[model samples]
Target: MAEQINLDKDDLITFFIHHLDKVYSAKSHLLKRLPEILYQVHFSDLEEAIFETIKVVELQRKRMAAIYELMGALKNEGSISGLTGLIDDSFEEIKTHQDNPELRDMSILFYMTNIEATEIASFQVLQLLAVKIRKERIKELIKENYNEAKADKALMLLITTKYLSTV
Candidate 1:
């Protein structure tokens, strides 16, 4: 059996900060991994799309960092184990499809979509927490982050659909 922990408002804020740190770490990891994934991609259009998204992701990471600074949270000690596992699984999937260009590209799009969905969900929670704690700036930042992630997910879905139809 697992132990259950209770959290008050302050503790919840701390937890939110910790989760934000995890998101920052995950984004950092993705930034490093995207180039390698891009190298594996053969389609020029898909590659360009991914490159543009990476720029957006970089900006989002900076925004998250700014929010962390606003919250007086400097350290990122917690790990988002689910994201770590998902990244590992995506790499494995990519490796398995290396010989198939279309499949590899599709896999990368799927992986990115999954990541965007996770970030959207996380930002939703963070937004609610910010509202609860009356952190207006944090709330606004989170809302902006959520919107960006949602747009990214939609873009990925559009690409996946168009690409698959052509193939």
Candidate 2:
């Protein structure tokens, strides 16, 4: 995992893009298994929960799309290198935003807080793939250029509040 990344914002963005692609691929593979799970499970409640989770995945896909937009904006402006420098110069920016537990909680709640909240089978698959991608991305950052502390900080930001459990 540590072998795959360069320690720069552009590199990080590229790594995440690739990682997301892998995740999407893995999820596509897992989608085939969903029908089996859907069949064997007798509980209608569980079925609904699984359906809701799939909806959440769709929402997450949109979020990733937005992230890609930001990535594109950075690239189009020729700011990727500058952005990397900014990230390196002000590591505290990401940290300060993440340190507020209330903000973090609210953000997560805002995303998933809805009627009929239940455990979704699709979440397990998404969670596993997301974790793997994050782990690999961070490991790559750690190995190539950044100091241990900076690499660790980058990992923390990647996990953020939303992905902490998986991280």
Candidate 3:
């Protein structure tokens, strides 16, 4: 069972800002982890894809910073506990597959796809908030971030199905 919560306009705005903070935190956390994950990945194309995505992630972080500036909510601190927990779980999963390169690569790809999904969902929510608040530039920025996440997900799927095929 679950309880329903009600929020006024101001509360909604605050909640939105909090989520933006969490998105920023998630990006920051990924930036820190990507290099370590990249080192473990053996495929050249997948490695290149991750290297390119690092640049995109940096840009997304800057865009989030701009949004915070726009909303005058730069000081807000938020928890990205879900993303952090996912990353922690991924590390444990990677450890279990260390003796097998194929399994490790597959694990990493699946983990990245999950991360991309989370980023896409987060950006979508941000886009909705931007529209509701009439922040056209912010909405556009969030859309671009969402598109990058989708592309990253597609790349992971392609690598998993095409390059890593066991058949």
lDDT against the true structure, per candidate, is 0.82, 0.37, 0.81
Q: What's the CA RMSD of model 3 in angstroms?
A: 3.4
Off by over 4 Å in 3: 1-7, 75-77
Ranked candidates, highest lDDT first: 1, 3, 2
> Among these predicted structures, which one has the highest lDDT?
1
Worst ten in a row by lDDT for model 2: 111-120
Show model 1 residue runs off by greater than 4 Å. 1-7
Best by TM-score: 1
- Candidate 1 vs candidate 3: the lDDT winner is 1
lDDT of 2: 0.37
Clashing pairs in 1: none
TM-score order, best first, reads: 1, 3, 2
lDDT of 3 by residue, 74-163 (tens): 645445477766776776787798888778888888888888888889889888887877779889888989999999999988888876
User: Backbone clashes per model, in order?
Assistant: 0, 2, 0
Q: In candidate 3, residue 112 scores what lDDT?
A: 86
Which of the predicted structures, 2 or 3, would earn the higher lDDT when compared with the native? 3
lDDT of 2 by residue, 1-167 (tens): 46784466556556556544443333333233334333333334344544544554454444445544644522122232322333223322323435564443333222222111211222333334434545453333223212322333333334344344433
